[model samples]
Target: MTRWRFAQGVAALAAVLLLVALWAGAPEAPEAPIEALPIADVVSERLTTLGSVVGLAGSGDSHAWLGIPFAAPPAGELRWRPPRRPEPWTDTFDALAYGSPCVQLASGFGGVSDQDPGSFAGDEDCLYLNIWSPRFDAAEVPTGDDRMPVMVWIHGGGNTIGYAGSFYEGSLLATRHRVVVVSVNYRLGALGWLAHPALLAGAEEGEPKSGNFGTLDLIAALGWVGENIEFFGGDPDSVTIFGESAGGKNVLSLLASPMAAGLFHRAIVQSGAVDTVSLASAVNYTDEEPPGDSFSAKEVVLRLLIRDGSASDRASARFFAEGLEDSEIAAYLRRKTAEEILSAYRDEPDSADIRPPRVIRDGVVLPHRRLLDLFAEPGAFRGVPIILGSNRDEIKLFLSQDPAWVSRSLGVVTRVRDGARYNFVSGMHSDLWKVWGVDEPAAALSRSQEAGVYAYRFDWDEEPVRMGTDLGMLLGAAHGLEIPFVFGHFRFGDEATAKLIFDEADEPGRRFISDAMMSYWAEFAYAGTPGRGRSGGLPEWSAWGSDVGQFLVFDTAADGGIRMSTDTLSTQGLLARLEGDTNLDQTEKCELYRDLFEGSADWNQATYSGLGDRGCPPESLNTARSD
Candidate 1:
């Protein structure tokens, strides 16, 4: 009788276990095949306003339509002008490959390159966009309430480099999250942001003359999405624009731009700051009394004329350039090859990188007011929900390559020369970045806009120790490192580069964090608030509040997992912290202060002068460092 009772108890326990398993449920299955959707047949063709486009198969049950022109090529006569709608075509367009990247001097770090670094790559006619969506049949395309939210990605390279290349492929994000992903290419460098008066001599009356042609390119791309995203199973009314670094800066520009209003519903800026060029800085000669940018339109023209043997020296070149009529100057500039025009503005004598003034505040495209001021004023800028974020060690990416802070072996392996000094400088700079890019902006937007303003600090730094190098300590949540995690892509550059930063041992934690980030991003796109993420199972991400230091910290379980924190940063607070530190001498402190003051938007001469009277001149600060 006891044995019989035991058997019955065991059966009851088994039943309960089965019930629990049913309630908990299993993981979502891999993406469904096209045939599984409620459609008559699979169709990879999409009819757009420009033409009918056929897409190719993409990773993980997604379809990709690449090289679709949204605007007329901004080349020759169209250069430096607002983008116009592309001429329509009758034949079916094969959008199987990406368009040429916008013209830029190649950099192995961010810019596109097939040749050696510093060599020029890409083309003048590169106003195209790529789209990725879940594979669907023609008859089963989602419409009306079922249409998915759309996300448009803007690549970052200081607005001078980068392209919508394969490195940022959107298949994983789109397929996994059930959202439409679009990546765009815009004009870069001087070809996109020149503000010479000669180019505007015969401009039409209502045309934007702000010399922010790159900004206009984004506006035009959003316009395209608004008109035609429905054909790709996306809702036109629910568009979110997101970017990193300079791309994030562009997102902020769109928020400030009256021309870009109503084009996007939400925005996400990852490590982006507010910086705009003045009209004088964009057009004046560097030698003028108030002196313009070293690579201003006039300065570049002078250099080009000298390089062409039309003038012997700076004084003579300026004289020759000033002698030309407006029409003559316009004709002369147009006659120069793209290479000649680009090479004239190299950042260094031997480097092909050019850092010219961009996003001009010409009182038309962008308001004359500053971004923070505009955000503080109700209704002055777009009131959409915004997510502002920065990495924990934002400066480590650049500093890791600097010879002053680190030593490299064979130009591949690297080690920090002075760990304490390296951490101190990187931490301070990174904190300042948060002050400018995330905290300050979040506070301003929260005060002005009714929509939710969210803030985040990405703290996932799990790089492996390879070749006696501790990558985690060296890079540690560095700038641009969060990009792949956001997109669920781990592969960047060759296998060696990928292996150096990511290790198979860390895969489980890396994927967990990536999944959490994507969930938060997609949820925000869907409802303008990340809330408890898509599943409503993660930690709640509260919007910015009146209290201090409210933000979601993204990390893995091994490193505290996803949680909220109350740690905040400010210019005054950072200054105080720096003053109290005993790790560095007065000279070092002043040098660091110089860099901070130069980078800070709240530059105050009085505050800088009060720093120990260490003889640090505020004039020594490089105002062009942000570029």
Candidate 2:
């Protein structure tokens, strides 16, 4: 290990030793005094919206202001409402500590740590944001009008289980790239998206009563940055909004929403598709149906009413709810705690309502239609530079969650049947879902808007998987794998998983990838183009329009690191390839087809419409539904 790494290890070991000694009641050891850290006063000489904030400096001269509240506490009457500005305070708000995460389901991730003394795993009053900056002087008191480009991060946890503190550690990016970094926390799960007629009835005049409170919260945070980021030496006008998965989905919503027109100058959507359900469909959530279709707040409320014995059945609950006066229902809903409301959707993991469609087509925070459809329209979104990307093995994360699904899909009966075919199918699925989801919208943006749209495919597969399991190969640049590399956060998430994903041996490759990725990202945030500003010795990244249909592939290679290539697969293309391979028997082809199409709504739709154009028999494309 390098000297810096060795020192970190020693410090960690010393911390462990200290903890053990304290637990064992051993004699106290002498305290080793350390030098004080550098700090920067983010408060400018001029008056600002946020009174003042001081940022503590880290190893690379990067300064951080943690847990700054961006909005008023969204509790009580504001539980499911749009976020409001925080009341200005006279006292200086200390931002050294992390703010509480919005109320969410328990995740095995480190953010949900009960062990941490002041961890806020499930707190309702959680509309906070954090900032990281590279500008610091000898006194480290943010001494200039030097405005650094800003990158605001929105973390991904299926819109249910992540916080700004969990996934983002921005010092590396800020210092290395000379950019300002901001990460935010918004409401999650039911608390974030709950929409009932009672709540709608209580809405103030001209206020949007859409169930997308989480989205509105993000808009408010962006507005806060626009109004107050100058104090932190940040150029709010050059802000780039980037996020992964659910966060990426939010970025897409922001692009399509009129309210977010002037909030950000650029956007990056990673592994998140532009898909949404209508408010009518989401509020009518149910459990009897399969996934993706049913996501009803009504069902949850029904379950709540039944659990509390307030109603005998769905009928009675409906009668009581529909029959009651708007004020009465509102009063009853407001009485229920966040925990009680979240409990209704916790037990059934397979239920359609589990991840209810938080992105609503409510014509307020979002457009009154599918995001993809909006992108298709000419001049639909703001003409901002955009980067759309997805990992190679995106489906592996979901497959790992259900090993049985993996086994059935891949025909892994004994000794993992046909590994090559399994890999092919997995790749095909990633392309169909993510590439089609991301690339299509990118193409739409390129055709419609003047701003450039860039595409990327994260293909890093060098990390070692857990011993005795094929997760390493299975999770080749899976859904969330690119995030750690992008943020230079190899040691993030839980310790065990962190170790599994980022081994010590892979440090060189990881570091190389991190430098390249951060350079590209920061460059994009700064100059509207990823390859234009301070490239840091990385190769050129061509824009999507220039290349027609190519993507920048991220991986470690001896010849060249990042290469441009086309994501070569489609729903029909894969089936045609499988059919052409006469070496495989009909049974194998059928099984592959079944796996590809079963509960695979898009593929099923294509096959139902007739696969004759793709040289596949309609009867041959059979699908089997598996749990």
The most accurate candidate by lDDT is 1
Candidate 2 lDDT by residue in tens digits, 106-207: 544424544342222478989999988874652443434458888999987777767888458888888888888999998887788877767777888777
Predicted candidate 1 versus true structure: per-residue lDDT over 571-617, tens digit per residue: 88998888888878878877787766664455566666667536455
Candidate 1, pairs of clashing residues? none
Q: Which residue pairs does candidate 2 place in steric collision?
A: 284-296, 285-295, 285-296
lDDT for position 587 in model 1: 81
- For model 1 the local lDDT of residue 373 reads 79
Q: Judged by lDDT against the true structure, how good is candidate 1?
A: 0.80
**Residue 295, model 2, lDDT:** 37
lDDT for 252 (candidate 2): 87
Which residue runs does candidate 1 get wrong by more than 4 Å?
1-42, 287-290, 410-412, 546-549, 599-601, 612-627
Number of colliding residue pairs in model 1: 0
lDDT of 2 at 156: 74
User: What is the C-alpha local distance difference test score of each model?
Assistant: 0.80, 0.68
